[model samples]
Target: MPSVEILSRIQFAFTIAFHYIYPPLSIGLGLCLVIMEGMYLRTGIKMYEDITRFWIKIFALIFGIGVATGIVMEFEFGTNWAVYSRYVGDIFGSALAAEGIFAFALESGFLGILLFGWNRVSKGVHFFSTIMVAMGSIFSALWIVIANSWQQTPTGYIIEGEGLEARAIITDFWEMVFNPSSVDRFSHVIIGSFLAGSFLVMSVAAWYIVKKRFVEPAKAMFKVGLCVATVAALAQLFTGHRSAHYVSEYQPAKLAAMEGHYDSSAVAAMYIVGWVDAKSGKTTGIKIPGGLSFLTHGSFNAPVTGLNAFPGTERPSAVNFVFQTYHIMISIGMFLIALTLTACFLLWKKKLFSQKWLMTIFIWAVLLPQIANQAGWYAAEVGRQPWVVYGLLRTSDALSKEVKAEQVVFSLVLFSLVYTLLLVLFLYLLNKKIVHGPEMTPNEEDDSDEFSKRNIKQLQA
Candidate 1:
């Protein structure tokens, strides 16, 4: 049996990983909703309104699931990680409070208007509501990322006690919010969310085209999705580079683990594909010599601090695991960039939709962004291993002292069963919606008062 600590960690990781799937979808879909509704208001085109209305239902479903799953982490924090919770309560409390006031309030307040206000409110008012909901989602991400980044590179707080009694007290709120890693990590996370949203759009649209249903609206949606995907995929390269630089500066040991670099005296080699023999400190792969050094320091000869620089107990234990996950994320990012860029080029040449092979690929490409997001998250969190809050606290010391291994195992099993059921239901509902297509009745497709009256009646029904 795993130790109580191990079981607890596994449980938390399982819950968080499962919960993570929906937020990116919600955030990304929020942006697409904004764009679609904006287009509706700008052009007075009923097709755009139909598209916006269709995705709003999907967005609401994702948001609900995301909220439901996210609440579990709060309980886990108190029940499984009591010590850690007490230690960082002040800091976390402030950030979460801000999320409620500035993020969730704005989002939830306007969400009803965005959803059911289609005929109840004017088009301009509805569009404004859509914009508010989108911005609110982004703000929610901003605060959450800030809190997590503080764990990575702690600042703007003072340690108030020692040993088990120690707590972090916020001294500079803005400084904490803008900690060294926060901006870069936030950008990376948000851009990744955009890719997820856009890819989902493309997948559904491509499916529609392939099935020869609602081809025109699907093309319009596909075009919007492709544009968003292209910009986001390209932006990811810059954000990833920026994040790497920050990691190299603030968390050298993690950076070393990510690349499987073990020789303190040598410039790091960046692997394209690799296997690490941690026992022997040998990493075998096709790699560019000094590639990591050059990327981090702009000099091929620059030496990077490596695993050897850290004490055995201080360095990440699962070095190879971090290396593989980090590499997988990088590889997926490159693939997305290539795929989107090529698709954009083909689109420019007017041959995009006809490319059945590429359309088929897009139909499944929704998984890539989700995979990359999960992989990147794992690499970052695991790479800092041994520490739940980086230099401030060790993960081993953060667990609730009285929690038994059996208790944790039981809860883990229960969570797994519930989450599996939730996932199945989500997929079933999503597939039903997709199959239904975005059908606009001839009466609802009109621009006159008749369209308004029909929409109101449909809403009442």
Candidate 2:
């Protein structure tokens, strides 16, 4: 039989990795829907309306998958991490409740209006629904980050008693919301969402450009995506910098592990690229000297703490892998921002679309931001070593006591197989929708007219 620790880690990793595949798309698509609807409103263009409707179909599909996978994660909290739940149930329960009440309800509610009511509502009203859907996504992210930030910084909670009877309770709601890491982390993540959505739009547009199809629709989508990508990319950089500084101050060990520095020193050099050797607690490969200090403290001579400062038991090895990976992710984000901005400038100067090479690069650039978003989340969650609830309980102590290693392994394998099938099905469906494109007849206006007639009859009653 596999060890209990191995089984638990496997289950957690499988569930989380599956859960992640959907939310970023949902969050990003929410903004894209808003932009599409707004463009239709401004220009009274039927093609824009058609494109919006087409993408919304895909968004709805993804949103449903996101909700389904997300629900599974909650159940695993009770099943796989029962002990952890019992310990921080009060804190997480509140944050989760808020997510349901504030984010999920708003999202699902307006989603009905945005999707089905498209035909039944007026232009202005339909536009408002799209805005609400976007707001809902942002609200959803806020509560989730609040919960995760608590895990990282762990504020406004008190631990009472000891052993199996121990519990962590919330003392202040606002304090929890405005936790030290919450704001920067939230901004960085939300901007990443924007980047994801913008690039997806750009990708589809690029496909159209290559095929020389849907010229007007593709151009409009590309322009909107370019603007969003540029802004989000810039904001992400700034927020990432701020978050790194926050990590330096509040979670010095994580900061140290990320840089792979074994000893504390002033003017620490950041390794822009490297392979970390866990046994020696050092990194090898390419290095950028003095960059770490400058990035963390905005000074070349600022003292940066190292891994040796922490107790042997407290140091996390695999967590450092996540840290290093996050830097690579950020570098990818920076490169995309520069490349997209340059493309945008060229497009504005009427030189971009004509260049086949540039168009080819833009077509394939969608994957970069997606990688960065996933990597950033990995860094945040993995960096909080030992503690599942940050100072309240260690992960080793928070696993299910009643569960057997064999049972957990069985379930882990089952989950992986099932999730793999579901992923394949989802991808197939998504590709079908993309390849079919928007239908020409029975457009958004026609749908709206039919809805108005039905509504008038109801009003007469």
Candidate 3:
């Protein structure tokens, strides 16, 4: 019971991490489905139609999981954080309701058509449904990002009460939606989602290539996945820079913790890699000279805030955790960029699918973006620390007082068991899909003998 706070936090984090895996995937797959179907419509390629069908199954699977796990998060608010829920109810209600009405409705309405209407509906109509579903997924992300960004940099709200009764009231809904960090963070997240989605596609395709299953289809799928991955990984670099600067302006302490800046300096160096020593309050590692200062303030000599600027209590509780996770995310992102570029070059050379070693690396590399995405979220949330709504609400004060430590501990255990089962099931099913590979039509099956010969030669070579 003494560890109730920790238990509750773990419970929420565990459920959220599991839930998070799917929505972003569904979002990415939603777009991928759009692209596949669009290509089929444009080129009248039967192969594209086959690929569309294949990925549609994967997308639907993740979408269902996302919904099932996501419901837990919704119920969690009232159960674990009633005080926080009541306070942000008005603001969250608006965003979530809009998502339900505008996003979910659009997605649900068209999902049926998208999954089932290939033969029944006109191609044009089905294409329209795919587009709608993609748009809905994006709009859903938009609202959720807006709500979270508001918490990061609260605006357009006023506190209407005191003590336990205090609540936020909207002043300008648009201002709330477009809060200070919203745009930058939103861009970062969607691209990260896309990056994860592309990784998933690439990993599966990579598996197929290495295992000598679904050769031509896997090659085609890998091409689309690589195209998406390369573009997204590159775009993230620029978007990440913009988001970092936004953090510098709005949440200096969080940024300070992320970069392991211990003391204010005009020529702050960004650690390319480092470890933080909490006892000594120092970070030691090889770092680019003046890189952090330049990125944060647009000049090498520009001053950057350090943890010392804020009281110790105001800073994130887990500096090492924040610092390590933030840097690990960056390291993975950079590695992915390099990997994608190299893959692009190999693709141009017409040797992408032939490279057994590269394909092997890619099969495992798909999990990198998921780790990076979760790390980014952990850094953002933990670095915000102490505060649940930035300057307005402390996290401790936001807890539901009526809930006891024993209850929270029990619920955490229950959630852990449930989530563990879900993870096992997801892995089993996903593995089955990958091993099964895409089913080729009779004509395509006949056509693959030549394709198989081509791959056989590559394997021999």
Point to the candidate with the largest lDDT. Answer: 1
lDDT of 2: 0.79
In model 1, what lDDT does residue 65 have? 90
Clashes of 2: 1
Indicate the worst ten consecutive residues by lDDT in candidate 1.
445-454
Q: What does candidate 2's lDDT look like per residue over 126-176, in tens digits?
A: 889888888888898888888888888888878876898788888888887
Q: Candidate 3: deviation at residue 393, Å?
A: 0.1
Model 1 TM-score (2 dp)? 0.96
Worst-scoring 10-residue span by lDDT in model 3: 447-456
Cα lDDT of model 3 by residue, 1-461, tens digit:
46656767788888999899998888877777788788778777567788788898888888888889999988888888888898898899999999999999999999999889979999999999999988898899999999989889999999998988999999999999999999999999999998888889889989888887777778878888898889999999998999998888889999989988888554678998899997888899999878898887778887788988888878897999999999989999999999999999999999888899999999999889999999999999999988889988888888888888889888888888988998899888987887776766555545443344443454334
Q: Each candidate's lDDT (Cα)?
A: 0.91, 0.79, 0.86
TM-score per candidate, in order? 0.96, 0.92, 0.96
Instruction: Quote the RMSD, in angstroms, for model 3.
Output: 2.9
Candidate 1 residue 295 Cα shift, in angstroms, is 0.6
Off by over 4 Å in 1: 443-461
Q: How far off is model 1, as Cα RMSD?
A: 4.6
